[model samples]
Target: MSLAERLVRLPDPRRRRGVRHPFVAVLLIAASAVAAGARSYAAIGQWARSAPQQTLARLGARLLTSLNVRIAPSGSTIRRIVSTVCPGGLADLMGEAPTGAPAVAVDGKSARGSRTDTALAAHLLSAVTATGRVVSQLRVPDKTNEISTFTALLAPFDLTGTVVTADALHTQREHAKWLVEVKKAHYLLVVKCNQPNLHAAVRALPWQEVTARRYDRGRGHGRRETRSVRTLTVTGLGLDFPHVVQAVKILRHRTNVKSGKVTRQIVYAITDMTAREASPQFIGRIARSQWGIEAVHHVRDTTFAEDASQIRTGYGPENMATLRNLAINRLREHGHTSIAAGLREMSYEPFTRPLDLLGVAP
Candidate 1:
């Protein structure tokens, strides 16, 4: 189904009587506007009003006055419907990924714009694929945090044969067991000071004897970096972690090209993936792929200005975040590597361009 069709499947929370705008149209407009670089409700409403009559009709936008004179939903209408719509349902509708041994990175981010006196910024845990597809997301409830919400965020996914990677905060024994024993999936969890014994044990393993090792180097943005990863099969180490067949250590050496400044650090992780199931090179790739979640957040904050937005009331922040995710995924699907440029291009012709993103182009 098309993106519009997928959006229309969400249950509308608005009352029926005297409704001037269709909820689906409001959502579609908001999504398209965000995809086209409209950051706030006012910008979304402006984009909707500026859309061509033919484009609005193709998006199934309701007629506020007459068929001959097309009108778009105002900022309030868009914000109401968008904030009230279920974020999880929208994510399920848009987060359709193919089956494979995909590397899924689980991470959390806080919307700085949502901060208020009574509450802190909105914290959300998201599972993103290595290719930058958002598989699922859940808001970290008030009085709680990401560690408490990690398992629940992953419950809706079919994780069989997938390698799930997470930071040290989620490196709990129960989570590791659940991923391996219950979900039939593999896990590569980082070990840090949070789990002292595991970190020490993993760090103490004799990695030099391991035959499987990998090295990679890259240069970009005025920096040169080298990464080396070594994997060792842990046998009888008596570690408390469950189903850990191998441990890995990644050493990163980075230098500033201009300033000649150098920095080096070592990171550790334990995984159920055997040396045969995933070579050291593959493990290195999965380890590096964990940054994909950060990339998604970066786009939302910088390109979409999600952190600077002031729409924190009700479900507005969550709803806007979901729409932003859809926008990014849509652009990526269309082969746009640079989100800023894509948004700028769409911003130039908001009236006609959004139709293509809505899959309602004539």
Candidate 2:
């Protein structure tokens, strides 16, 4: 079946009037609002009312025979209908992933302004793919951590044959065990201060004692900076750690010029992959992927103006953030030459017209 047909087949809770056309209208409005950079209900209403009536005419072909195409839904009416449907139901309709995807990263972000006089700040956990699509998400109270929300967020999707990665905050023994033992998925987690013994042992490895050396250099600001990294892989270290197949030490030395003076800094990382499984190139790539969460957050905050959204109601902030994610993924899927260019094009006047530029019909 076609994309619209698959979408309409998904469950929606708001069936009060036995009219399906209005429901499809609301879905179309929501999709267009996200494409045009309307992140909240109010902005969506404004866009819907301001849109030319012809913009929705195509949806008539998709409606059931019993439903009339002449009927139009008011902004408030669409909002109420949309708000009544469960977020998970809507996400299912939007396509999480096709089969055979490799990895899914779980991370959390706090909506900086979504706090109330009586409620705690809103925190969200999103399961995003490696190519930067948010597959699914869940919201938790401010007092809880990502671990508290991980299982619930992961419950709805298939996890077999996929690798789950997260920052050190979620590198708990139980979390790792659950991903490996319960979910039957491999895990690549960052080791940090939270696991004191693992951190110390990985830090104390005989990196200096090993005989391996690698150096890389690049130019910036008309000056040259050189970095040297050495790796030492040790097995049978007599360290008891959970889900740790092998331990490694990475020593990085950087020399840069600041105000005509040179400076240096060192950093390290610990992983569950063995030296055999994780070559120098492999480790470097994985380390870089850790910043995927940062990229998602940066786009949401700056390009989408997420910080400026004043949605501070019950679950409103979290839900709007999810919409922003949906918008980002949809834009990425449509093959924008670059995300910045995509955002700039969407920010222009008559934003809806640019859908044709991206090969998407209204």
Candidate 3:
């Protein structure tokens, strides 16, 4: 079924007394507008007003009194529908990934523009695959944090045999145990000063004599970085966390090509993979893939203007964010790496371009 057909499963939140626009149609317009570079609610409304009748019709909009025209929902109507629709339902609809995601990264992003004195911004915890597919997302509840919401964010997916990676903040003993025992998944967690003992032990491993298990060098944005990694089996290390296998230490040297200034840094990571199961190279790749979610956040904030969006009311901010990610994932699926360029192309041919993205025919 097409995306429009699938969206009809969501229950409409509005009253039937005086409803004008179809809920699914309004959602389609909102999604298509975001895909076409509509940065704000006003822009979304404007896009609806200017959309071609055939495009609107294909997206489920109704016929108007004139046969050649379609009724576009007003800005307020679109805002209300979008802000009231269940974010969880929309997230499910938008987050469709293929089976067998080997490595998944969990991270959190706060909508900075939604901050107010009455409440903090909308903070959402998301699970994304190594290839930039957002599998799921959940809102971190008020007065709570991502640590408390991590399990909820990842609970819906079948994670058996998948390697889940997260930043140090999510490296709790309970989380590690749950991922291993409950989900039947492996975990690669970074160890920072947050867990003092584990960090100290990982730092204390004898490494001068150990050969480099992995080496990678790359240059980007006028800077060059070289990474050397070594691994140690910590099965009997008596660590505080549950399940033990390997510990990793990495040294990074970064240099500025123009100024010839060099800087060095160290990082530590832990994983449940044994030497036979996952080599140092696999661990390093999964470690690097953890930043894929960060890249998605950067794209949302920079290309989609997510951080600048001021839709702070109700579910509006998070729903808008889901649409933004939908656009990014759509563009990536269509073989566009540059989201800015994709937006321009979609907008240049607004009538058919956005519909093509929405899986609608015109």
Give each model's clash number: 0, 0, 0
lDDT of 3 at 318: 87
Model 3 weakest 10-residue run by lDDT: 60-69
Write candidate 3's Cα lDDT for 209-321 as tens digits. 66639998989769999988788887886766688688888788999999999999888888888888778788888887797789989898998878888889989988998
Better of 1 and 2 by TM-score: 1
Candidate 3: what lDDT? 0.86
Q: Rank the candidates by lDDT, best first.
A: 3, 1, 2
lDDT (0-100) at residue 355 of candidate 3?
Answer: 80
What TM-score against the true fold does each predicted structure earn? Answer: 0.95, 0.80, 0.95
Cα error of candidate 3 at position 85, Å: 1.1
Instruction: Evaluate all candidate structures by whole-model CA lDDT and list the values in order.
Output: 0.83, 0.64, 0.86
Query: Tens digits of per-residue lDDT for model 2 on 144-224?
Result: 777888888776777876767788788777777777778777667766777888778777887767655456666654456
lDDT of 1 by residue, 9-41 (tens): 888898888888777777777877887788889
